[model samples]
Target: MSKKHLIDRINTQFGENLNAGNTCFSSINKSKQVWWANIHLSKFADEVHLLLAGTGHFLWVTLPKDFVHNLSETFKIREDKNAVDLEISADKDSRYLIDVKSGGTGFDFRKYVREEVGY
Candidate 1:
């Protein structure tokens, strides 16, 4: 599919504003492009969000539920690696903090959405 179509599809699918990031994934080498999608899922809970990294020359984002149905039907995640990793710590003042590393199959956002979010 054309990059424009892909970007539109992605935006229509996951409500996260995507853009061309400086980082490029290995998969993009095969196709020669890079893109990223960041989404926030407040309905699930505050501060909870989903990030998508892929290889479409163009980028875009949308709501998970909005694009979930199409995503589930269109893409399939080839890799099972954790896309997002988190680390949690507690402080002496009874406060907790978390750190997250977001990485996963840098391919199709739809596939990532379906596998990660189970849409």
Candidate 2:
């Protein structure tokens, strides 16, 4: 599908605020158990680093394999109200951290797949 088509699909499935950002295109692939989201966080935020740092919590819901490889490479788990900080490195070395918050939505892989991929 086209870039605009995919972005529109993602936004409709996820939320209207879902930004495609600088990375105009999204690569969808398949893996064992989940669907991954590989997009630039900046599209949803003004400053990625600042937003992550300010928020004590965020959720990292791993997408399926196809989407996983498309996302930013590295992810860091910031300090949360109930969890400790951690880091997950991707093969491509793209540092993309998703902060966890107490009030934030918990990790839901299936929901993401259903929304983004229309599974």
Candidate 3:
């Protein structure tokens, strides 16, 4: 799926307050276009939701806002872009990453996703 689809998924589950060109999202559906000197709802940065969807792997994570508070100490600033790269590890062999961008911040999300169809 593309970036718009990701944002649409979020909007579909949540509400319209967090939509494109508006609302409290640092960036919805990250793109290489925004990888350099991007802009969005940085003002509402709190509780990061790391959403990944592709291939056979679909993972979503909720990180504490303070997770990226300390740059040099906790996170790594990407020399390649205007963003930071984060590493999220679930186990020794399984690790996820937030590469070149941070997103989906703002709003108290008790639930950011809802299943349209069950397994």
The most accurate candidate by TM-score is 3
Tens digits of per-residue lDDT, candidate 1, 1-119, equal: 44344434545776544343311122122232222222212231222223333333222222334433432233232234312222211121322221211333222333322322211
Question: In candidate 2, which residue ranges exceed 4 Å CA deviation?
Answer: 10-15, 22-25, 28-116
Task: Give each model's clash number.
Answer: 7, 16, 0
TM-score of each: 0.22, 0.25, 0.43
RMSD of each: 15.9, 14.0, 8.5
lDDT of 3 by residue, 91-115 (tens): 3232223233344332222244332
Q: Please, what are the lDDT tens digits per residue for candidate 2 over residues 30-117? A: 3311123333443323311111111222222323334333222333223332222222222123323222223323322223323224
Show the colliding residue pairs in model 3. none
Reference-based lDDT, each prediction: 0.29, 0.30, 0.38
- Distance from true location, Cα of 39 in model 3, Å: 11
User: Where does candidate 3 stray beyond 4 Å?
Assistant: 16-44, 87-119
Clashes of 2: 16
